[model samples]
Target: MLVVWDSTVNIYSCAVEGQEGLHSPVVCFQVKVTPQQFSAYKTLTCSTTCTLTGNPTYIWYKNGQIVTDNTSPYSVLPNAVDSYSCAVKGQEYLHSPAVCVQGQSCNRVTYTKRRICVLKGSTVDMSCTVGYYSTTSTFWFRSDKSTPEDLTRDPGYTGRVKHTGTYKGPFILRISGLIEEDSAEYRFTFKTYNFEWGHSFPGTTLSVTGLQVKVTPAAEGQKTLTCSTTCTLTDNPTYIWYKNGQNVQDNSSPMYSISSEDADSYYCAVKGHNGLSSPAVYGPKTTVSVSPSGEIVEGSSVTLTCSSDANPPVQSYTWWYKKNGGDYQSMTGPHHVFNQIQSSDSGEYYCEAQNEMGTDWSRTINMDVKYDPKSTSVSVSPSGEIVEGSSVTLTCSSDANPPVDKYTWYKKNGASLTGSEKTYNFTTISSEDRGEYYCGAENKYGHLNSSSVSVDVQYDPKNTSVSVSPSGDIVEGSSVTLTCSSDANPPVDKYTWYFQNKTFQNGFGQMYNISKFKSKDNGHYHCEAWNGRGSMNSTALMISLPGKQTSVMNAAVGIIVVVLVLILCLSGLMWFRKKASKSTSDTRHTADNGQGDSSPVYDNISGMAMNPTAAQTAATDDQDDVHYASVHFSRAKYEEVPLYSNVQLPQPQKQDEDFQYAAVKFNLPSAAPK
Candidate 1:
């Protein structure tokens, strides 16, 4: 049995009838296609040999329908494209494999698809041509799909394609509003009118280019940067320009604006590529400074040093000067020297140094020249006045380059010397030490003498007045004082006190004191004092014993005796009465008897007148004129009785109280012979 099947046929079979009654030697046959069926188009045809065997009947099916009267060793219609298969009916063992037909042409030409570049938001035309086509149906395919899918049917490409002339023999395709993803490989198909067709594979590379923005400056101008790229574009490429790592906008072509200060790092970039690499950076600055130059005095020496902290540090220094002398000159070195400096050597001066980077100037120095001297001076201590016997010091001061070597002491009396000891001291000063003194400072240059200092030695008392401590009439051992003072050339040395007529000397009297006063102590006391010059003495004062005041008491007794004699003689009338009474009684009793009684009466009257108011006159008893005479006789007898008794009288008898006194008559004593 034999059978054939092409790729167009999905199934095929054969039927047997009246087989149920058959008894002996009966066989049924069937054929199946392996790997289905295969096909070929155009100049392709089926083979004469079949894959089926055993010489039996065959059947073919098309699209799930049966076909009769199809017989051949292979299949019907050889050299034609078909969808048919074959089956075999046999007595035994019937199965056949399916086969496919491939085609080849004598002259085959591949069609080339056209691609183009366009600006953003523009249409893209894609046209292609193939060498072979007959009644070809043209179609488009996209390369992004696994099985070349139709690109005309994709929504992203809607309204984006316009087939020029109904997709004729050489197809022309256009895509409008083309997106970035639309730019890829596409395959175009042309179907012939009688089922013959041609296909082509085409590819397009998409790129976008931006406007060039060149930031370059003109010659002799600031530095500038630029940005640029290539022409044809499908998807718009993003631009990212950088300046020192910062984003920038560069819209103008061949001219991007920037400032002179913006000369630092610069570059440009595109979205699909790495950062830019065009512009370069610049550095290292320079500046200039202006300064004054020269010295403060004309022609004076001055130095100035200039330096800078620059990239290539300063190398050489130069001095540019307006002569402090009013001229201009140039010189080298940092210092300028002028010998035997003059007044013209004073002015303003400065300096400058130069390097590959820049130059700098220094500050000005003003110098002046003059003269001053150094020497020593002399001075005195206790400056003003000089007194005698008082200590004094004279000092000399001086200043020299190498210092002074010697000090000389000099006297006004032509005495001079050089040594560390410039002073002379006198212990027991005399009038000789009171003179003018001068001093000098001596080195190599001879001597200089200071002014003289004249001293006056004065002599004033040390103890002016001497005193005895116990006050008036001081006794021995009572401690007396002696002080001596004088306004003398020198001072007092010792004190000497004198007692009596002797310079007091003993175990007791040291100066003005004595332990005991003997009889020899009562005399004038004097004190004397002396120094080197002379002596002085105080006035003498006598000293005596404490109780010797008797001469004052004897003068008081003689004044009492002269007062007693004057009181006794004051009573003269008592004496006169006693004398006159005796005379009158003698005459009246005896001698007047022959004469008249007148003589007796006359004597009585005279006695009464003489002793007026006498006691005897009051005692008499008679009141007669003769009674006056008796009073005379009684008074005469009382007066005539002697104060002292011549002879002794007898003792009188006792009487009573009534007895009266009688007048006594007595004889007168005779006168004494002369």
Candidate 2:
């Protein structure tokens, strides 16, 4: 009977020359008499070939007893060397045996290994070593996570090449077309003829990488393409390209570059004797977003929004501020509010949006704010002098939020006046009302004072009168008094006395005494009373010395009579007397007194007796001594005498009127009439 090997055998099946089945009736070796078949000796190790056919199961036997499943072909148990036998499947078991016998030894030909390669677009013999294989497996992989599975074949390598060899010889895999994804480690597994157990060598990492098949712009058709591999190799790589996952013709080199219509998604694979790496993927999606910078008014609130799109979502938003030459600062929120705006608020602003992919910023913005001035000041019309009962206007204006609403008028006399800064009239003016008045303007905030104005009221004196005591002329030396009184609107502030045009006394009440009255003191006198309005004078009065006026009039009349008598006497004596006497023609006579006492010239004759010559001489003497009292003296009467006689004939000139000449004796004293 044929025996099976243990599970440790790596190469469970192998293609032998003319082998088909193991169950065909055949000879069986004697159990003990076969000399413990020492068919061959070999060593084993992990190899890429062991992975062929998805890690083929193997069985090992020692002295016809089963060994535990351990390594690939057999497990000698460390220093336990022994003869072993392996059983495997074959194509023609009727012509050959399914079992191969060998001995495990410390020094044996088991170290010798084989390589494998799969044809393009076909399942690969993963047991083949990469570099040792003359031809590599074409783009094949076992996708099983724990153990190897069925191999995938690349379509581009189909029908291009084939793999043929013993399971132990170089199991090279081959393909005509090269592709970028065809490069990788390939596994090859096989067994020796004498050593029933199969062994494996480390897998050979294949690098069938080639130049990237790239479709550049037609203008750049002459650009060079590059092909490289991480492993060092003696043979230069050959490149074949596929456009849009299809084979490309007329392109060969380690690097194939073209601007042809089939050059889109062009992929070139390297083919020497190794596998290829995966294609480098490069279709990165890129996008961009645009936004406008926001504008902010100085002293006002503003909002800034930033937007962007990327492969990943944006994480956070941030704002940045930029002045003419200042650094940037991050903002918590897009909106900024300032209770009180200042000049510094004016500048440019920007925002930035960030994500795991990248970051973007918005355009700069500008801000502007408006400003207003304060309230206008107020003033009064007539600033300093507002009269009593007179109206004044106070104007109020301002540059505040709201205009002045209403105005209040205040009187300085501790009284509240009317509303509205102006007044129309005072019913009547009185001195009782006069003081300072100021106005206050009202706004949203409070009150402000208008310029102050003052008022003054004037009046005239009333019920005025003047009195002089004793009801007589005021004498210079005697005591006399004057009093002035009045009832005035503002009160009689002062009393002034006037004598003639001179001012004497001034006060509310005055008593003027004439201590010594002189002639000069004799004149019209008056009193004046004054108030705030004006001063007024009293009716005139006279103050004088007693009896002074009458005495002066009498003395003037007496002097007038004495002047008239002296003028007439001197005229008569000079021219008429002597001439008249000489012209006496007919009547030259002596005259006598009629009465004994005296003689008077009268219309009738009065005679006096005396010696004629003596009398005549005496009369001449008397004329010489006495001055004529009046030119009205009657002509002296003379007696008729001889014309030649020297006679005094002064009377004879009057003889025509009186016709009586009288002579007086020189020695007699003159008599007077009552």
Candidate 3:
């Protein structure tokens, strides 16, 4: 007979009816469920590797407990937590291995570890097993909030968290350089075509902690140092010891013994993870050193490093420097670097190293950076207007590591003026010295030139003169102009004109014009050119009329002479007429006395100078008539002067008496008598 219990199945030999000491062939079977997946109802089936002797009854069990004694196929409601098995009734002692009802296709998750603990600055991996029908996506997330957030997308875990594994499998979440804030519950989630694994399932919780050294008193002036943590570290890792930043020992024990007088700082770390070490515990001793240790020069790379022997090392370093008697300024870093040093960077410098324990200062160091002159310039003394013949000075200034050894002066578009002197002086500055000037400053390293400065000289007008247009022999009734010119530092601003020692009202400009020149316009003319500095007068210019005017005076004198001659001739004529009148009166009286008997007597006094034929005719006509005088004048031609004649006659005789008169004519010779 064969018998089975809830926990075990046994097989035994029975006395057969005809044969004893013989038993049926041993048999083995396996338990299987229909569809091989979880459901509300499942059918349990049993199968054997070898054939049974006859029709065999079936037996079934659930979770190590009998559910039925005989059945064609056992049936039950399946669950994930229960186990089931089946066997033939006669061979019940050889039952099949127990199997969970829910198979590989169940929608569930199981974390490998419920909780994990790790040291700060170390890496940790959380793993889980997943079961699903057909997963589309899977990821690891932190379950600290109601909404699950993927660790890979979290801001605090960027670049430090990652996920590894396939869908519906053992998934892993790896986080490096862990900190205290990384302590949280981490979960795994997956999604199928229609269903998603719920996030309410429990997940693995992580705890991150830091290491510290605990010092304790010991015998014989000795100290015991233990590398301790807030919680027990994972993997039971070995501890390493460091003295003054140097590795000393590594062992499984966390305690280390040392002398109490040891001044060196001590720290510890895990054997495999030396970078994540405990904080050193000691008094801070700070010092600073420069890299590329030599004389620093301009445009060279330099670095200053601050070192300290402090419990936690130097968390911050501050650098302070002073240059050219100025105030001190600060910079922060473990290393203060100058990518390209300058002349102004030459100064006294020091550093301060600080930690949680305390702070310490380094010794002051003078950084005398050698370089060429910089910020070179030329400064002029008496920066006002530079007048000609005035004393002036030009000084060269620069900033250099080594004081400028040589100074040079230069003029634009000219040669160097001075050498090796800081200042250039001019006792008597002239117009020739006015130009653009610059200075060159030099040291042992290099040389540089400053920007140019303009020197302008101011002076009064000079070399003044007046120029005349239409230069020679100015004629009357013609136009003329006088222009004034002068040489001056600044152009002549005002011009004045003078005519015969008097200012011309219309001559207020550089040019004086005479539209219609007359004799009165001829005189001495001058011009005065003026500027802001002073004024100057030009030499007098003589203006005279031409010789055509002298002929007019000669014609006027000739007319006056002709008028005097005419007056003399008229006076002589008047005198002769008076004498003639007196003679005529005497002759008339004597003739009247002698002429008694006027009808019978006749006097033949022919005093008329006439032509012969005219006189004979007059004598025959009137024998008794007496004529005193008669004058005849002819008409003058063109261009000839007319002559006037005056005649006086006696009183008229009786009206009835006959009076005959003869005209007399006198002819003057064309040529004068010798």
Among these predictions, the greatest lDDT belongs to 3
- Residues 138-238 of candidate 1 have per-residue lDDT tens digits of 56677466775566677777767776534334566677665556656565654445443322222333332333434444455454554554543334545
Task: Go through the candidates in order and give the clash count of each.
Answer: 53, 79, 2
Candidate 2 residue lDDT tens string, 1-674: 23222112223232322553542232221111122235433343222211234344444444233454444544233333344443332311111112222232221112112222322332332223212112222222322214532233434445653554442344455444544455554444332333332222123344443323232334443433334444333334356555556656333355554533321343456454224422531222222222223433335444445554432345566767655456776674434545555446555666666543345666676544333323334455566644444554545554432345666767775866766743424556566655666666666545666555555554576556777777865556666677777756566777877767677744336567665557867767778888766778887765567766633345565455444543554444334345436644422332232222222222111233333334334445554454332234434544433322233333235343344432322223363110
lDDT accuracy of residue 531 in candidate 3? 82
Kindly list the per-residue Cα lDDT of model 3 for residues 410-435, writing each as its tens digit.
99999998567999998999878889
Winner on lDDT between 1 and 3 is 3
Q: What is the alpha-carbon lDDT of model 3 when measured against the actual structure? A: 0.71
The TM-score between candidate 1 and the true structure equals: 0.20
lDDT of 3 at 366: 85
Per-candidate TM equals: 0.20, 0.23, 0.41
**Model 3, position 617: C-alpha lDDT score:** 38
| Top candidate by TM-score | 3
